[model samples]
Target chain A: MNESGHNGLVERVAHELKRSIKIDPSFDESVMAEVRRHGKPAMWVRVIAWWRRPQQLSLSPLSMAASAAVLILAVAVSPVRFGNPDGVEPIAEDPAARVIRFELDAPRASSVTLSGDFNDWDLEATPMTRTSSGEWVTTVKLVPGRYEYTFVVDGDKWVPDPAAPPSLFDDFGGTSSTITVPEV
Target chain B: MVESDGQLVRSVLAGDVDRYAILVERYRDRLGRYAYRMLGNLEDSEEVLQDTFVRAFKSLKNCQDPELFGRWVFKILVNRARTAGSIRGRRDRLFVTDEIAILNASDMKQSEYGWREEIERALSELPADQREAFILKYVEELRYDEMAEVTGVGVSALKMRVNRACRRLRELLEGVYRE
Candidate 1:
């Protein structure tokens, strides 16, 4: 075949190939139903839901009362030393190094691991222990810096911490929670 | 005035979930054609299309450029078609010629020529990458840059794939046309 003949054949093929199939009229409605079924809440809605969730207090009432009483007794026993009698000022202790407790409510998860920038995103670095109340808990001593992290449930399923600040979507198509550890 | 895809995307993101139907209606036929050619079956194509729309709706916010919503959704459709194709491959034999497709082709041509079957056979015989490149280039009439954006492959590589696909397709269908 000549050049134009081959070109004509190709064009014919393209034309035939480009023919639109008659889609089912109800396909759009079916797709919309599926979309509604799997609808993701807006970012602000997720934020509001997180905000409205009931918080679990870490300390028992008896322990809190005892701590308050001890603090009051210590303040009463200590002399009012507004400024040191000596000319020297007391050196402040380093507050950058501290432990932050991370917790998640995953009662059904057999194992939960925490991975983040702190541990180079290693899945096995920090495994969370399940409390009797079915909360997965872990406390990691992190330096004062912003860290991105996610919880791995059952060795897969990376999930962002619900209680943490807003998360950014990672390159791997998952969201990572961000935490800024402030100096005490 | 008709709203652009960007406006619809924004409305959907702003809690007007129903606005997404506009996008689905707009792109379904076009994307459905691409999926039908890619998968060679209407049922699989519809399944992939449904999946693509649902995914696009859920991830509408993650779309970096709402103005390029068509391209973004096309990319998702391509990926879903690939995945669905492979899964379908494992479960069933590849490429069962659809009776409806053949009937439609006969209706269009008003003749008994089975050119559509031959073309679909030729297309199904090509490697997935080459077939995708060819369909995007010729049938979809996408530029190399746009093809690159959709497939995440370099322009030169896509060009080579399209060339190879054309050569292979012509070879496959040469006897059919000669007859």
Candidate 2:
């Protein structure tokens, strides 16, 4: 009787909650219809967006403090982060004289590839082999300069670093991280 | 009826606006629920969800990960809800979009305001972090990892907030939800 009572309790709670709100089945269609009202996105949109960012950008100490606070909020409030032992190995301290590492917490991806301006945006510059725990890791030698980079997972999807340095605002209006590789 | 999120993103990037429909369809329910939970108003949730997609589409190129579509949209929705809530607060009436009457109905049932008011007041009493954690974990049904992606916080803190929120909620809803 106790077991039956517990089951009944769960059912009643579920029923009451389900009765509270209603959502349309075709919500996606409506939203898509709304989006199409503006037309298709431009090909090379990211590249174009990148070129249009405030070209005269500069970083200052004050900006760093503000960005750090915002960063802390973004970090603490967000449910995802970089460097999980059970997630990504967080690149074992770079050994090369001028080393840069790219990591993504993609446990399901078979093979990850590194691509960005550092490789002249070459898709084949460095193909990241997966590790036992499933994160993809890759490193590239670099000269002291800033670079834009993204991870190509299993030959599909572009993922940015959720834990990198400040990214400039795209003219299209979202942020991506930037890496200012320092001189060794 | 569908393509992988990556395909849709590629199509969007390649100028196929229609592909966006799939993503909208894919995430519409989740996004709506998230908005509704956060704002507690269907109308405001709809508005926020609509605006989020609009902004996302306008800036699709910035969506670095199509597979992480849910997370990306979630981040956008979080920002929009915060903005909407703040703006509504200035009016001192919450600018409720079609939910106050229904949820707030219970007040008449009791000599006091009602169950709806109690729920809202109790939720409002929570610190933002704890409330967000509870809503996402319990109401949104997000796995801890997915919640992490959306909030960018450590799992331990999230666990603490959810636990505290649950304890507080049980205390607040003693007689109402208990029955």
User: Against the unseen true structure, what C-alpha lDDT does each candidate score?
Assistant: 0.77, 0.63
Against the native complex, each candidate's DockQ, computed on alpha carbons, is 0.18, 0.13
lDDT of each residue in A1-184, candidate 1, tens digit only: 6566667667877887887788999999999899888765566644433444344778889999999999899878877554757645554434576898999999999999887756545556689999998899999988897887888787656677888864443422334688999876
State fnat for each of the candidate structures. Answer: 0.32, 0.23
- Candidate 2 displacement at residue B161 in angstroms: 2.1
What range of 10 consecutive residues in model 2 chain A has the weakest lDDT sum? Answer: A167-176
Q: Give the alpha carbon lDDT tens digit for every residue of B75-169 in model 2.
A: 77865665565444444544233364365565555623454455666665655567678777766677987776565445776888887876666
Clashes of 1: 0
Off by over 4 Å in 1: A43-184, B105-113
Interface root-mean-square deviation of model 2 in angstroms is 10.1
Q: Any residue pairs clashing in model 1, and if so which?
A: none
Model 1, B1-179: lDDT tens per residue?
88888777776776667878999999999999999888888888999999889877776755767778998889888767765766665567466685566666545664434777778788888877788899999999999988876754557878899989888877887867651
Query: What is the alpha-carbon interface RMSD for each candidate?
Result: 8.8, 10.1
Chain A TM-scores for all candidates read: 0.47, 0.43
Error of 1 at B177 (Å): 1.8
